[model samples]
Target: MSELCHQAGDARGMEDLMVDYYVDRPFFDELVGLFHERTLAETRAALEGGVEWIFANCYYNSLSAGWSPAIFREVFVPHLRAQVELVHRYGARLDYYDDGKLDASMELIADCGVDVLETCTPPPVGDLDLRRAKARIGAQTTLKGYVDLLWVVKHGTPELVERTVAEAMEIAKPGGGFIIGSSDCFREGTPPENMHSYFQACLNYGVYD
Candidate 1:
């Protein structure tokens, strides 16, 4: 969908349409409605199966999707709130995942009652400043994933992995809401030694007294 939107060269206009359901209100209604319908059904099914976590991976990264604050507040926040409510009603948590810049949407994500927000990708690949994210929304939502999976994890040395993990832990570990994880998946060709270093560093720095 993102690819199609970008290919159409109207991503921002797409966001604007979401702002008002502009071009076709009924179409937009059905589209957003479909999302809620399917999402709620799956949430119910997962909870009934006794799962404790509902990882809702919305790949429409707000930054890349051309989301403005209006798009978030007016378009996405309500649906996310509904998602959180349904999940919490069943004694489950919603871990929302979006794989692009998250700096601007962190507060709104937390405000929508999401329990966990993953892949809070930091700069170069993403724009999240972990220290600020920790300060702002850390009290409300669990801050997950800041390591650069492609660079520091897959391509870089074990020493770099350990250093990255250590730096992340130093900032996000203090208050206990952070999870040391990758910005995205460890892709194919990721070094096994790097994986080892990642966990070793986790144990080394992520241990809480």
Candidate 2:
């Protein structure tokens, strides 16, 4: 693992400095970086680290409601591709953590040779029809995480959680490549009851037999 020193300042300056520091380092096996002004530098560090893969986190909501693929291509894709290529040189993969409807970015993600994409939200927010996504991306690339954080385990009843998990298993387990996980990172406010219920649901439904 490579450590990235994130200093306090404008994003652009920090990214530039980070890139300068890691462009020729020899200690890390993987490097994770942020997008924005520092994306390019982060990409360079991945190259220096001899990283097998890089992970990126992206989110789209009310604050970024207008986010688009065009914007991603212009501001993020160039560096993302570079980092991915560096990892590929070492026979590695690039995984992105995007927890939103990515209808706009799917094609670009495919073009970048990203090996795994995680946290795909369901309808009302995302366009991931699991069957369709697998068809589009093919067997080479993997899709991870489809559990609903807000509904299946947060506000829903135990019966609802169990049913939802059962459905997910029925749909996603048919394929050998899917991974089950929460839609996003766990939040502190998530009720313990809900958490226990969700896991129990998974335990009861996730078995392949």
Candidate 3:
């Protein structure tokens, strides 16, 4: 779809339409409705199977090649709203994997009624702030992930890793909405001692009152 837009020389139009939905509303609507139906049905099945969380994966925008916030709100929010409603209908918490820079879209996501957010990165490497995000979402949503996988977990010493855990807790833990962990997986070559350090740190410092 994007390549087709590139061929047509209409960047703004492509993003705003978000799929040719503007030009071919009927087909787009039909396909989108089909997806919604299947997703909702599967979600219902999961609920019946005793799952408490309905997870989804969406990596639409990033700090590098992101669309306007307006475009996302107009083009994407409708579908997300419907999915969120479905999850809530089944009494399951809704959260999606957002593996890109979400500093700009966090507010919009919260508006779509997500119960929890995962893989939230921190700045200087990625673009997020734990304390600020906590303040922004308040009790409306839960924020998870933050400890750096590469710099701190893989490369940095165990002490640095411990400090990272302590700091993440200090900032976002006080309010009861943070889950401290790596931004993603600890790489294949990540030191075994580092892995030990991470779990131990979590146990030693992550106690809740």
Reference-based lDDT, each prediction: 0.80, 0.61, 0.71
Could you give the candidate ranking by lDDT, starting with the highest? 1, 3, 2
For each of the candidates, the C-alpha root-mean-square deviation to the true structure, in angstroms, is: 4.2, 8.1, 5.5
List where candidate 2 sits over 4 angstroms from the true fold. 1-53, 60-65, 204-209
- Per-residue CA lDDT of model 2 for 83-185, tens digit only, reads 5676677776777777787656765766777787777677655666766766666465667777777776677677777777777777777756666677887
lDDT of 3 by residue, 79-196 (tens): 6777788778878888765656777888888888988786787765678887788889847788888888988889988889988898888888886977777787778888888888
Residue lDDT tens for model 1, 101-140: 8888889889989899989898888889999999999999
TM per candidate: 0.86, 0.69, 0.80
TM-score for candidate 2: 0.69
Q: Considering only N, C-alpha and C atoms within 3 Å, which residue pairs clash in candidate 1? A: none
Winner on TM-score (1 vs 3): 1
User: Clash totals for all models, in order?
Assistant: 0, 0, 0
Instruction: Please give the lDDT score at residue 132 for candidate 1.
Output: 94
Our tally of clashes for model 2 stands at: 0
Structural RMSD, model 3: 5.5
